[model samples]
Target chain A: MIEVKNVAKKFGRKKVLKGVSFTAEKGQITCLIGINGVGKTTLLKAIMGLTPFDSGEILINGEKIHPGTYEKITFIPDTITMLPNMKIREAFTFMADFYNSWNAERAGELLKFFRLNEDDRISDLSKGNAAKVNLILGLALDVDYVLMDEPFSGIDIFSREQIADVFTSHLIEDRGVIITTHEINDIEHLIDKAVLLDNGVILKEFDTEEIRENEGKSVIDVMREVFQA
Target chain B: MNVKFNNRDPVYVQVIQHFKEQIATGIYEPGQEIPSRRELANQLKINPNTAQRAYKEMEEQGLIFTEGNLPSRITSDEKVFQRVREELILEAVGAFVDSIRTINVPLNEVLQLVEQNYHKKGDSL
Candidate 1:
């Protein structure tokens, strides 16, 4: 399990995450959902130890995050993180060199699944295809936890469908995932837990299935009530 | 199984309903092996846990059963199959009656409309 306990962060004067705490377990998808600027991405970054937290702790499998944590936890940022000028095949080779967890077979399958050409440069592909490549890079890893930031944002319908398919496929089997997104329609039924963030504070967190059965409300329904007030 | 799901109810419930409808409509035959949990999850693009929950519910309701290590299959017992078909038909009738009752139509008029519409497009019900 990945645990974030009382994590707090700020930039100059503005606080982004205020005592945020949550746990994402293996074999479950934990969703961080809210409007823009609510620190959704900041929380994801904090978990990755990419951005320093002011005062808090992050633990994976009951151990404090250390240098080796990156091997276990892979974070896919919203924007393309690959080199802009690198060809697709070169990018794959670059990733394979850096991480021992990179799976060449999985990368090959995802490349065919996404229908991405290896010869195309990163800067030459369309917005949707670029996102697919980003997803392929993240998913091709043999990691335990995956933290995604706005993976479905600003993509076309076809691309969105393809990305959504990754959740149901064996690509994410038995791995913990933390995804932050304002758009929930694409992953409504797939989310196991939901953390609702507002103004750097967690307004509510609950097992999505419990609320659905007890109150007949979906993630979107709960969001309407929580955000409208 | 091109199961079309809406966002209104819980997905597991919708999935269970879809399976029952499939059994009632003869899409799933008795003793036929159904998709594995992972296969259903991939085919329907739902969470694997949700598919597991749906399969569990169906097993509880005797709509499907597993034999030892084999994959789950539609129930082979004729009585169970008949019960599933009857339950689905009753549920549909109840929904139709409830909706028609809200409009305050007379029972005989409702029956006449049903008879006319049922044959209008060669619908089975």
Candidate 2:
């Protein structure tokens, strides 16, 4: 389980993640939905300890995680930043060395699941395949938490479904995930909790079913109401 | 299995998840003759390529094995069944965790609830 409390961050004169706070449960897929330029990526980076937050606290498994605890959360940024010339299998080996929780079998299965070749270089892969490689690496990590940024924003439809399947299969028991994405339809069923952000603040955070049953409206409908109102 | 006219995602891959669920719940048994590609595609309103993709995925996963061009049947492989069962169990556990978390139940309470339910079910049995 992970908790972010009163988290605040700023970039130059602009403030992002303005004292935002939320709890993501273990073994649950919690999604972050926000329009462009709303600090979704910044919040994720803060959680990963890749970016410094100005104030507030982050705790994973009740242990306060600061800049020093970056290992606890594995992140796959929207951009594919891995070396362009490394082979697919070599990427796995590199990951295994860096992450204590890397699972080779799971990684291999994911490569097959995504229909990716081990001999392919990261640079030679099309945009979709590179995303697939990022996904494989993120999912195969045995970390307590994963934070993905816009994982499906660029992939084609066919690759998108396969990405969803890979995401679904990577759910480990009691681990947590916070996926930031604009493509909600592709992952609607995969997400149990939704947090909507606007202007660097959480506008709505609720269980998807609670809104559906109590208000007779789906999360997408609620988002429309919030944005429209 | 039609490929060109259908989706590049492949029909057989689609069938893999569906039949895995069916087999997990005993809706489809080993040695059972699955519906033909044409019938399945019509039922699902998908192209034959999708059906083929599903079948091929299931076959590669060892859930089903085809002998010649005859009616494809579910594999009677016990090992495959056990693997599928474990995977389904893991999935069910994940869903259960998601359900509890959505209600904002604390982690300790959830673990206690699972423990209580486990014993209750054991006693009932």
Each prediction's RMSD over C-alphas, in Å, is 1.5, 17.5
TM-score of candidate 2 against the unseen true structure: 0.64
Query: lDDT by residue for model 2 over A112-218, one digit each (tens)?
Result: 98889999999999889899898888878777788889888978988886776555445434467888876577665456588988778888898764465466566
Relative to the unseen true structure, what is the C-alpha lDDT of residue B72 in candidate 1, on a scale of 0 to 100? 96
Residue-level lDDT of model 1, residues A29-111, one tens digit each, is: 99999886859988888888788999989899999879887778898887888999999999999989999999989898989
Stretches of candidate 2 above 4 Å error?
A66-71, B1-125
Query: Which number leads on DockQ?
Result: 1
Question: What does TM-score give for chain A of every model?
Answer: 0.97, 0.94
TM-score for chain B considered on its own, for each of the candidates:
0.92, 0.70
Candidate 2, DockQ score (0 to 1) = 0.02
Q: What tier of docking accuracy does candidate 2 attain? A: incorrect
Cα TM-score of candidate 1: 0.97
Which stretch of 10 consecutive residues in model 1 chain A shows the poorest summed lDDT? A165-174
